[model samples]
Target: MSGIVFAIPGDIDAPTGGYGYDRRLLREWHEAGIEARHIALPGSFPFPTEADLATTERLLAATAPDDVLLVDGLAFGAFPEALAARFADRLVALVHHPLAMETGLKPEAADTLRRSERLALARARTIVASSPTTRATLETEFGVPASEIVVAAPGCDPAPRASGSRGGAPLRLLAVGSLIPRKGYGDLVEAAAAIADRAWTLTIAGSPDHAPETAAQLRSVIARDGLADRIVLAGAVGPDKLAQLYDEADLFVMPSLYEGYGMVLTEALARGLPIVTTLSGAGAEALPDAAALKVPPGDAAALAKALARLIDAPAERRQRADAAWAAAGDLPRWSETARIVAEACLRDRASARNAARGFREKPMQDQRAREQD
Candidate 1:
């Protein structure tokens, strides 16, 4: 059997969550004996530009008709109808989260994007979401039938790192994600401020892409809260550096306002780090009950309380960390995720071929004429 080919528009350079998911998916597909390729699209603001469209067109023209085109949510959300029409027969869209529903966008812009997403999803041969929350939203918000959508949760790297020595004085806390409003970093900074007198240091690591204003606001908050000395912004570190940080950290916090599926949470869990997060999206669903400390989104006081609890109770923290490590062991590997995706793509392709053959064998108009006769 010929292998599946995925045409993803996720940028390879940046450290975005979607890019991480795509990277892992591709790795998994290859391990599962599925031939998968990612076509990088040009970077554009808000949506894919004319250049991106042209690049996608070129890729489509070159690809075999039977090859599965796995479109990422970013590109699908950006140019829904056109992509759907162009690759209607062999297209499967992977939605991490609904970009149109993010709170940061203007009402009119959000509405336009949402409309485009609906149209694009409708045109897909199959739609795979990263979380059940996303699947439900697709059915409820976009009116997509439940039967057409499948939920394939994101996977984490399984390798364990050697334990690093904890430095003296301050307890180390790490938060990793793009420095944006949705990440709730500003709120975390505020929470950090509330406990500034405590001996704890925070490292915020991620590349900034969207909402420069939010990044600016977070910086301002950090300075104003007198956390300048305690907080550090380590922008866009490589995987090795990130693994080192995770190994060294005493705690991990991701107070995201929303997520499709939180791959970072899984990564942190894999490192055996106790976590603090909000109940925002499907990503939060990955949290093991005993391993995580939950707080309401945008609530600095609650976050502060959670942080304080973790800091003050050393024995409990260690226990939670141990539990987190054990829970991480249960997460699906990239190879497993790839196998499921490859199987789904193969099934969709076979279904499309059968439908096409049926259409050719019995013309609808001819059947209607025979009924009349």
Candidate 2:
């Protein structure tokens, strides 16, 4: 009776990082003996139509007043007013990142999402940001109280160590993320172009379906630079295939403009792959400088320089990969994540029940004091 009612906007089995995290957490929580019920709220997400909003309202409205409702910020961000009127007392928000900060959104759309997200987050009993950076952003930028937010960073599962290229030519580079503007796939492609003269092959594994236009533009960039033959857009592979890529790769690269928590970075570490990534959002927090060659976000020149250095120096790549392997020991695993989230839920429910009990006893205590007086 005291379990989570987890809700998401679309297919929970989707291959994106957010949905991946969701699927992994649910599996972990269930393994830990938490009876979590999942409800899929069908919609396009962060841009839900009016009908979608109505559907969400009904879905939430059907929950018992005492039921614990955990909403993904994607859904809540779209229609906060509905949340304000419905499930304020027992709502917990899982925020990947503030929707308003997403790249390619217009000023007015961003403004509207910002206001709604801030208000919706305020209505939740507790909010869990996916990274410390995200937690800080929610606290400072969104005005959510520091005490109300929890930083339950994404978890990593163990994988086989990457058997690298063994100090040779044609260095293999792997990047994973959806082909979106914010993911900076275009920047990554442009950077690879600078080092086209070198012996390297870039394989970008992501879902181009997320943003076909961005994916098309990324292809255009590759074609324009005449490196189309060198870069391969292996659209969204399975875990087995991804793990195989990690095994086959000499280095891991993610040129994301922002990440709530760079799940792919942790994934790269799980395989002990050397990384050349931008120090944006949670990317730096995911891997240290000794473990990665970090560059400035959106700077193709700097990204290219980082990539070229690693490509040229096999010993340096080995050293960085070794450091990453060592540091991978400190990375939080899925069980730990499940435990942290379960404890938070249990603690929140305990507090809510204690408050309710105290409220029930208050009148009796007052009457007793009056009689004595």
Query: Which candidate gets the maximum lDDT versus the true structure?
Result: 2
**Could you give candidate 2's per-residue lDDT for residues 1-373 as a string of tens digits?**
4667788889887789888878877886665456577888965778887787778878877876656677777787776576554778778888889999898899999999999888888788888888899989998899999999878888776566888666655888999888999989888887887778899998999999977898999888888999888899999899889888889998999898888878889989867888988888775665877889888889989999999999889899889999988877666766556555555554456643533342344344434443453
Stretches off by above 4 angstroms in model 2 are 166-169, 347-373
Write candidate 1's Cα lDDT for 1-373 as tens digits. 4445666665665687778778877765554445667776555623777777787778776877777778778777776587678888888888888878776888988888999888888898888888889999999998889988878787666556426346576889999998877888878998888887778999999876567788888888888877888899888889889888887788999988888778888888877888888877766765887988988888989999999899888898888899987876566655445555665676556643532342342234433433353
- Each model's Cα RMSD: 11.0, 10.6
Report model 2's TM-score to 2 decimal places: 0.91
TM-scores, one per candidate: 0.88, 0.91
Q: Candidate 1 regions off by >4 Å?
A: 1-3, 80-82, 161-167, 348-373
What's the lDDT of the predicted structure labeled candidate 1? 0.77
Task: Provide backbone clash counts, one per model.
Answer: 1, 0
